[model samples]
Target chain A: MTSVQIEVFLQTLIAGLLLGGLYALIGLGMTLIMGVMKIINLAHGELMMVGMYIAYWMFVLFNIDPYLSVFIATPALFFLGIAIQKFLVNPVLKVESILPENQVILTVGIGMVLANLATVFFKSDYRSTPVAYATNAFYLSDFWETSPIELSLSVPWTVSFVFAVVITITLWFFLAKTDTGKSIRATAQDLEAAFLMGVNVKLMRVITFGIGAGLVGAAGCLFLPIYYLFPSLGGQFTLIAFVITILGGLGSTIGAIIGGLVLGVFESMTATYIGMGWAPVGRFVIFVVCLIFLPGGVASLLKRKKFGK
Target chain B: MKKFAPFIILTILAVIPLTGLSTYMLHILILVIMWSAIGMSWNLLGGYCGQVSFGHAAYFGVGAYTAGILYSKLGLSPWWGVPLSIVVVSVFSLVLGFIVLRLRGPFFALATLASGEVMRITTENLVDLTGGAMGILIQKRTWVDKTWYFYIILLIAASTFILVRKLMESKLGYYFVAIREDQDAAESLGINTTLYKTLALCISGVLTGIAGAFYTNYMGYIDPHVAFALHDISIITIMIVMVGGVATYWGPFVGALIMVLLAEVIRSMPGLGTAHQTLFGVLLIVIIIFLPNGIVGDYKKLKRLLGFRRAST
Candidate 1:
């Protein structure tokens, strides 16, 4: 490849890597919920939208930075998650229906209400948090005067990436160390087994759901400065999260992280090479391809390797 | 009364145009019939077969576009789309079923949903064939009066109702119910679950596609948004089945009437129009929690509750 071609490729890769880290954050919540509850949270993106709205209002009213609003939004989302689980989902779980997909349909309804209500109250406007350093960037040429090519890193993307890493590490530490976290994992492995082992499966389900909501809420806050938001944006992000969960092997956290990176890079590549409109198609191409060839997702491959079967 | 109820209702609907009702009312009736037709098609797959699809719009859009293409590109009448879509939608459904039928429950639902969205996006990008985002507009409409359109849709809806009823009474219907009750057991009983599931998907998809082709001719407009709508076409189809009653012959009809009337009433209210989806969402939640089997499915329970209330009062 020519110098310009190589530079373009490198630029796209860097941009994709930054985007992927954030995507992983979004996917993490969905994977966690699917793991513990054994139900896909179709309203995952709407919950993220709520978190973004909260951050937007905090920035507008209280003059707080988007990053700092994470602290506020996360806990609020945790409570919201608890309420939804207690009032809406738990009841449906007990309801006898021909179709076992009632919970999924219920989530779709919740998403519709959330999206429509936002449009009603917020007037369907595209919004963003206007941080002071929105355009602040670090240039490769500045750091290395003898550099052959130019590169710029936006301040917000880098900051978001770092925050995502830190949060993921914290999640790892908690899940690996804490008793509640262990119980949650145990429940995910085998619900009946966990119950037999004297773990409070009901409580763990609620807490896992809350943590999922809280984590995605933090992800929304991280995304606020870099991306624009509207109420309907949740639907697309919901698809993105769903795709990631599938790619990552249903409820596997590590798989979700890898799937997020793969999707992010692939999406950006299509946006750069193909026209922008075809990017969504690329996302689905990856999804359909994964479904057909690797139905068990990346986690299955990991399992195969570990088991040496 | 129960035995002759369908014929009586069909006769009443057939004669409604002669009543000199206003054009607006005729339009509403047309919509109600069309939606019920779509709902019945959905019910065939979702209710009896237990394969809930969230992307009937994919078939719907493809059907609309088929007719639209015939009129605009082939210089043929839009009516050709109705017959041709049977062949077209069956092929598409077979392909779609091959991929989606592998997954069960919510995964299947999600896969279908994505397929609808993918078709929309593909159509939007295929500007030459689909006219891009501008969509297709038939310069001439089939008729200026609403009566012909009403009768045509009514005919379609009636046939659909009959087809579903006949299918349900046959051995095929028993197979579907068995698969729904337990796939593993059905497989053990030598019922090729995959073949039956694929058959159900094709029938349901073809039926919805026919309705869509009818929609294109009736509306004289075909856009990716209107034809392949997720919330509007797909969700509403599911909602009809959900509200009316799953797996019941008359549920789709009842649900369609209520939903259509509800939409019209809500849309007429200037303030409540934007909040319609919120109401829909709340209704869905309440039904899932309280009714679970929809109005027709749980009407006995509903009536008992009402009777108890009357006794108390």
Candidate 2:
């Protein structure tokens, strides 16, 4: 392994890992909604756009640092999610019971409304939070590389990778250990059973939505330094998030983190090796093949191996 | 009674182009007619079969690009290209259906979406072939007049509606309704769910492809953005069908007309150019909330409300 090659690999790995963190955050929200609401929330991307805009304004108007304003922005988005579920989503739940197609129309219609609403209010101009470190990359020593196996090489990523790992681990612990987390899981397993067990299913759903929104809010803060933020930018991220959510196993948060990182690196490598135009096609091929082979997601594969499905 | 319905609808539609409408109004009407055909075809697969596609634009784009490419590069008549495009896209749809039709619900939608985006990006990136983002513009031939285009679109729309109406009234329609209601139950009853789904998709794709060919030829231009946007597919097939009444014949036709007419009226309003989408959003919300069944569906509802006997499905 030459020094320059090692440097390039490190850079790619760091970029891929940071990108994965953003994917995980967005995927968390989507998976959360899927687990609790049983709705795909096609408008999830627009919600992320909302988060980015909120962060963008906080930076531009009040001179607030993107990372620091996560505290405030997260709660605001949380409230927005709660309100959407309570007012917009609840009414349609009944309708969907009668007509399953109603949910698709409702969520897709909401997505369209959100996108155009953002366009009307924000004027479709792309804006981002301008932080001092937006483009700053920390280059580690240029001579550190080792090949672990024939096909795989090990490279050390910088702070961005650490940030992603830390956030993912934090979320994993929170979900595994917290009482509210238990409520969410219980709700996901079976709504009626959870209700019989005295769980406030609706309250849990609202909180789950809030938590998901808050996660995306944090992701917006993290993402501002890495990529260009625009209203329509959410579309790209949302698609990737869906891939991650599916790859991870539809309702599993930890699976989202691992699956997102894998997908990010896979896509990065494909785009690097193949034509950029083919990258999307490659990703779709992966999705299709996975759906064919492991329709239950990677986590389900693990579950089946463990429990004998 | 069923025999006269198609004749009555075709007669009424035939007079539309010759009614002395303005070119601009005629243009909008042409678009409405084109979309009505596309929407009804979409309703066959999505609304009837319960297999929602967020990627119908793939077939539409294939049709447009096929015809456009043949005409520009090979000096072939568009008439030749239209059928070729339909064959190409129908095959594409069949293969795509084979891959995706087994997946149920949201996964199916997501898979189709991924495929559509991939196609869009491919079209935009293949600059030499697809003209990239700038798109391809064909020279307008004088013989293919705008009024002729209008009647052509009308004929296509009327025929598509009749074909779908026939299919819906057939035994295949019963199988589709059964699949939509409950796939497992239908399968248990010996309905070959896969065959019916692929059949529906093939039919849907061919019609949508033809509409795409008509659009490109009439406008004399083709672009990736308009050709493969998920928004276009969703709005035409999903929203129109939802507003009209999913799984119902004539739903998408009535829905597309109502939507296009309303959209044209809104766009014509001065100072409302940028806010036009907001109107669409509002209309969508209104349709979803109050009039969950679209105009025709609402008509039936109102009739039943006024002490009329319920019409059989």
Candidate 3:
């Protein structure tokens, strides 16, 4: 390939890696909720949207940096998630229904409400953080004058990627070292067992939902500088997160991270090779292929290899 | 009187267009009927078969586009798209069913949702065939008067009601309910779960498609977004079934009526117009929590709850 082609390829790869980091964060939240609740949170993306809106307003009203808004929005979203679980979802779980998908539908309702409220309060017009350094980037040519190819990474994207990695590491540590985290993990593995151990299964479910919401909210804050904000945009992200979870194998955190990177790279390739509009199609294509060929996802394969299956 | 109630309601509905009501009311009635038909189809799969599809718009959009394409490309009347969509949507659902029917519960629902998005993106990109995002406009509507349109939709809705009622009473319907109640048990009992699920999906898709075709002809325009809308067509279909009555015969119709009226009221509110979805979201959450079986399914509970409050008052 020509030097220009190589440069384009490298740029796309770098962009995809950056995107994957944020995607992993988004997927991590949904997967965690799915793990503990055993119910798909359709409003997962909307929780992120709520986070984004909070960040947007923080920037608009108070001149707060989007990254700093993460601290504020994450806890607020956690409480919001708690309220939804305690009120909306808990009732649905108790109410005897013919269809077992009531909680999922309830999440859809919650998502709809959140999205519409945003549309009402913050119109449908697309908005983005006008961070001064958004355009600032590290150029290969600037670093190496005699470099064979040219490539650049946007400053905000690099910062967001770094933040995502740090948050992911923190999440990993919390899940591994913390008592509440272990309880949450135990609840996910076996609800009855966890209950038998006096883990407060109900409280764990609520907290898991909160952490899931908070994680996605933080992802929203990280994504704000690099991505545009809109009310209805949540649905697309919801699909993206769903795809990542399926690709990563239901509730596997490590798998979600790997799936996110693969998806990001694949999407980047599609955008570069095909067309920008087809990027969403690439996401679903990977999803369908995963369902067909690897129904268990990356997590299952990892487990099988470890077990020598 | 109870047995004849459906016939009585049908007769009343048939004559209402003759009462010289305003055109606006007629328009609203048309939407209610259209939505009712779609809701009934959804109820069959989601309520009875226990397959809660989140992407009925795939069929709905195809049905609309089938008619829209006929008018725009084939130089045929859009009305012909209605009958044609039944065949088109059935075949379409069968192909889609091969994949989605493999998964159960949430996975199946998400797969169907993905399929709807796929159809939408395909249509948007295939501008030559579908007019893509530009949409198709039927320049000459078959009838300027809304009477014929209303009658046609009413006929569709009435037939849908009859078909649903008869199907539920038949063996096929029993199998659907059995699958919904317990897939493994049904399978152990020699019910071909896959075949039955596919059949249910086909019928459900065909019915929703018919509504879509009718919409294209009545509205004289078809677009990917409107036809295959996730929230408007798909979720509203679920909401209709959830709010009215999940498995009841009259549930879809009642739900559609209330929803359409609620929409009109919400839309007319000046400052709160954009918040209509918020109201719908609230209503759905309330229904799921308070009346999980919907208004008709939980009739006794609803009545008792109201009666107890009345007695206290």
Candidate 1's displacement at residue A26, Å, is 1.6
Reference-based lDDT, residue A22, model 1: 87
List, for all models, the DockQ compared with the true complex: 0.85, 0.46, 0.79
CAPRI band for model 2:
acceptable
Each candidate structure's TM-score, on Cα atoms with residue i matched to residue i, is 0.98, 0.92, 0.98
Which pairs of residues clash in candidate 3, taking residues 3 or more apart in a chain or in different chains?
none
Candidate 3 chain A, poorest ten consecutive residues by summed lDDT: A276-285
**Cα miss at B70, model 3 (Å)?**
1.1
lDDT of 2 by residue, B53-101 (tens): 8788888888888888887778787656677987788788888888888
Give the alpha carbon lDDT tens digit for every residue of B121-165 in model 3.
989988899988999999998899999999999999988888988
Q: Write the per-residue lDDT of candidate 3 for residues A279-309, one digit (tens) a residue.
A: 9888888998898899989999999999999
Badly placed stretches (over 4 Å) of model 1 are none
Best by DockQ: 1
DockQ versus reference, model 2? 0.46
Model 1, residue A118: distance off in Å is 0.3
Alpha carbon lDDT at B269, candidate 2? 83
Model 3 spans with C-alpha error above 4 angstroms: none
